[model samples]
Each structure stands twice: as C-alpha cells, then as structure tokens.
Target: MRETLAKWRPAIDEAIADLIPREIDVDYLESFFGEATYEYDPDGLQRALSDPIWELLDRGGKRWRAVLFLVFIDAFGEDPAAYLPYACIPEILHNGTIIVDDVEDEAAMRRGEPALHHLYGEDVALNAGNAMYFLPLKILTRDPANLPADRRLAAYEMLMDELNRTHLGQGMDICWHNERDVRVTPEQYLEMCACKTGCLGRIVARLAAIITDQPAEVEEAVARYAELTAVAFQIGDDILDVENSLGRAGEFGKEFGNDIREGKKTLLVIHAIEKSDPERARRLQEILQADTNTDEEVLEALSIIEDTGGLACARERALDLAAEARAEIDGLDFDPGTVDKLHEFTEFVIDRDA
Candidate 1:
C-alpha cells in the first residue's frame, strides 16, 4: 500500500500544480479589482494570490484524500492516472479548508510550519483560501479529465454539495464552542464528523462512480464505506491529540493539548462529561469553558478523561467504525485484491499517528 501510494503522490501533486493557476491573468485581475487596481502592479496581485496557495500546497501533507480517490479508481478497474486530476480536486479543497480552519482556530502551525495566516496575515490567507474553494470549479468545467458533459456536471454538483455539507459541519462546531452551556451528544458528534470529514471521502467515491458510469447502488455503497472510514479517522485524530500531547508533542505538526485549550468538544470530552462524577464533570466543563487553560489544567482534564473511561470508549468506537467500514467494502463488487487494499487503508486511517 505504501509503495502504491508513493507512486501516485507525485502524479497527484503534478495534477494539482497544473490545475491551480500559477499566475493570475491580467484580465482576471482587471475584472476582480477594477481598472484602477489593474493599473497597479498586476504581478504583485498575482503573487499575493498565488504565493500563499503554493506555499500551503508545497508545505506537504499525506494527501490521504487523493490517495483514497485513486484507490477507488483502481478498485473500479479504471486507469487511475486518467483520473488523477479529479483525484486532486478534493485534496486542494481540503488544504484550502485547512488554511481557513487554522485562522478560525487560531492555530500557529500546520505541517510543522507557521500557518499561512500567521505568515501572510489573515487577509491574504483568507483570499487564498477562498480562491482554492472556487478554483476547482474551473478545472471541472474545463473538463481536464475529458469527462462527458453530463458527468462533469454531476461531479460539479456533488462537489458543491460536499462543500456545503462541510461548511455546515464547521458551523455546528463553531456554534457549539461558542455556546458554553451546550452539550454535544455522541450521536451529534458523529453527525458532525460525517459532515466535516466524511463528505470529502463520499464526494470522491460518488464522483469517481459517476465518471465511470457505475450503478447508483455501487456509488451508495462506496460512499458508505468512505463515510464510516471518516468517522473512525476523526475519532482517531481526537485520540492522537491526547497521545501526542503526552508523549509525541510537535511530532504531528500541531500543538500539544491545543484542542483542550480551544475547548473543542471532541468525542472523548463529550463521553467524559457524561461518564464522570458530578464534581469531575463540573471541573471538566470549567476547564473547557475557560478562555485559556494552563498546561497543568490541560493535563488535569486529560487525566479525568482517561480515568472516566472516555479514552477507552473513544478508542473502541473508532475500531468499531473501522471494522464497519471494511465490512461495507465486502458488500461491494470490487476485486478481492482491491478489497484487501481498501481494508488495509482503513486500518491505516485509524492507526496513523499524524
């Protein structure tokens, strides 16, 4: 699986580099900023937009979303190279969201470097982030993959729906964080995970199926598999936050206990609140609600979460979801080898440290 992914990663990167505009055209600048601004250094404007976009892309991520897309393409017996451009669209969208998320979360680092917003200021980061959000539409409509018009339209619609769902999930997270009195249930947390993390996986599966003319049932099954994987992936991430803070801080390119400081309502936190004694629960809430928490306070909260069995519950749930995801692949008509790879990838999703 690692060898296969290694071979595909460069192709995915090339596709992204080709699709994302390297230089902003003069006419686009004129239209965007009006003639007065166009009279200014267009090169400067172009650099302002293109620099941050490339910086973030080049910063390097695991490119898991694109890898999943190619894996699905292979599973469906298609030429994965032919669909490389399509595979890259989700990754670009994912990176764009990361930039925006960092700004919103006040994160200082990403991929082990200063967050784009921190380097270029929020204004430039916001502009580049929004550009990434809409830029893939250009690639889709242009039919770089030479998909049929109907298929292109279908992919476009699916991408739009996925973006909408992701935003809605982010909105819920933001709202929950702001409303100090609000308590999130496990079901609600899973729903949010489906929207925020699962949507991209679902989009890739459904779009690949659409492009390849798969039946609706196959598309639905593939999407379900991806969604389940996403749920497990998110739970794994929450668990990592605690683990990384305790032993592997800075290894994952994110701050240790940052989630705790931000008062994120992760699944473990939710479970801990529900399972803890009243006094412990109250203390947990107090720590989470604070605008800032000391490292010692964060450690205390982590200890409470562990003692109350929240960590164990979260780990079990993640493993269960991963198992469910693999089982869904069994119901599909993919080749046995492909199914094996998919199962392996699902395990990797939960087991990955970063």
Candidate 2:
C-alpha cells in the first residue's frame, strides 16, 4: 500500500498542478476579478491568489482521498489512470475546505507552515478557497469523451451534495461551540463527523461507482464503508491531538491541543463533560468558553478528560468504527485482492499517527 501511494502521489500532484496551474498571467487575473487599475501590476492580484493556492496545495498532504478513489478503480479492474482527473477532484475539494477551515478556526499553522489566511490574509484565502470549490466542475465537464454528460452531471451533483452537507455540518459545529446552552452528545458529534468528514469519503467512493457504471447497491455499500472510515479517521485525529500534546508536539505537523484551543466539541471533550463531577464540569466549560486559554489550562483540561476516561472511550469507539468499516469492505463483492487492500486502507485510516 505504501509503495502504491508513493508511486501515485507525485502523479496526483502533477495532475493538480496542471489543472490549477502554478502561475496565472496578470491579464487573466484582472479580467477574472474585474480589476481596472491605471497602474496594472503584472504580479498583483494574480500572484496573490495563485501563489497561496499553489502553496497550500504543494505543502504536502497524504492524498489519501485520491488514493481511495484510485483504489476503488483498481478494485474494479479498471484503469485508475483514466480517472485521475476525477480522483483529483476530492483532494482539491478537501484542500479548499482546509484553507477556509483554517480561517474559520483561526488556525495558526497547517502542514508545518503558516496557513493560507495567515500568509495571504483572510480575504485572499477565502476567495481562493471558494474558487477552488468550483474548479472541479470544469474538470468533470471538460471532455465528453472522457466522462459522459450523464455521468459528469451525476458526479457534479454528488460533489455539490457532499459540499452542502459539509457546510451544514460546519454550521452545527460553529453553533455548538458558540452557544453556551447547547449540550452536545456523542450521537451529535458522530453526525457532525459524518457530514463534515465522512461526506467527502462517500463522494470519492460514489464518484468511482458512477464513473465505472457500477450497480447502485455497490455504490451504497462503498459509501457506507467510506463513511465509517471517515468517522473513525476523525476520532483518531482528535485522540492524536490530545496524545500529541503530552509529548509529541511537532510530530504531526500540527500544533498540539489545537482542538481545545478552538473549543471544538471533540468526542473526548464531550465524553469528559458527560462524566465529570459538577466542579470539574464547570471548570471544563470555563476553559472551553474562555477567549484564550493558557497552555497550563489546556494541559489541565487534558488531564481532566483523561481522568474521566474520555480518551479511552473515544479510542474504543474509533476501534469499533474501524471494525465496522472493515466489515463493510469485506461485504463488497470486489476482487479478493481489492478487499484486502481496502481492509489495509481501513486500518491506515484508523491508526495513522499524523
């Protein structure tokens, strides 16, 4: 699996670069943005927009989403290379969200570098991110020979549906964090994860099915597998955030305790609050609600969450979810080799350290 990923990662990166381009001429930018300045700077808005977009893309992601799409293609005994453009769509969409999410989360760093908003300001980052959301449409509809109009339309609609669900999930997350009276349960958290994270995974699998002209039942099964993997992936991420803070700072290319800093309603935090005594619960709420918490305060919150068995509970849930995902993969009628690869991928999703 690692070898396959290594071989394909560069190809995926090149495809994205070709699709997006590293440099956009100033004339194109001016026309695109409707700028009519007397002193037209060749390297003005065009560089401003294209630079950050490329920078973020080049900063090195695992490209797991693209790999998942290709793996599905391979499982079906199809030429994965033929669907490279479509496979790139999910990664592009995911990175676009990362840019916007960092701005919304006020994240200071991403992939071991300053976030797009931090480097290029929120306005530019926001515009670039939003623009990226539509770029995939062009790819999907570019060549009728490559992707039939019907299938293209289907993929486009699926992409839109997934993005809509993602925004709705983001709304829920924002509202929960800001509203002091809102009480978030584990079920609510899972739903949010399904929307925000799982939806992308579903899109990838479903798109593969659509492009390959697979039966509806197979698409449904693959979607279920992807959704379970996504939820488990998110849980693992939350757990890593806390565990990383203890002694693994800089290991994951992200700041430790970032979720706590953002006041995110992680499963660990939710479980901890549910099980905490009155005094500890109050303190936890105070920490999460504060405008800014010190490192010590964040550490204390982690300790409290640990004492309440929140971390352990979240880990157990993640393992269960991963197991379920594996089961779904097994149930699929793909080649046995494909099933084995998928099972391996499921474990990777759940057990990835970074």
lDDT of every predicted structure (CA atoms): 0.83, 0.82
The local distance difference test score of model 1 is 0.83
**lDDT at 252, model 2:** 31
Q: Per-residue lDDT for 1-354 in model 1, tens only?
A: 777778788888888866655676766555444577336676786667778988988877878788888888887888888888788777888888999999987888888899999899999998889877877667676676687788888888788888899988888888898988538899999999999888978987887788887888888888899999988989999998887786743343337687888888999999988998989999988999999887778888888888988878899999999999888889888888888888987886556865
Error of model 2, residue 158, in angstroms: 1.4
Q: What is the lDDT of candidate 2?
A: 0.82
Candidate 2, residues 276-316, lDDT tens digits: the string is 99789888878888888887788888888989998789989
Give per-model TM-scores.
0.90, 0.89
Look at candidate 1 and tell me the lDDT of residue 180.
Answer: 83
After superposing candidate 1 on the true structure, give the runs of residues whose Cα lies further than 4 Å from its correct spot: 21-42, 246-256
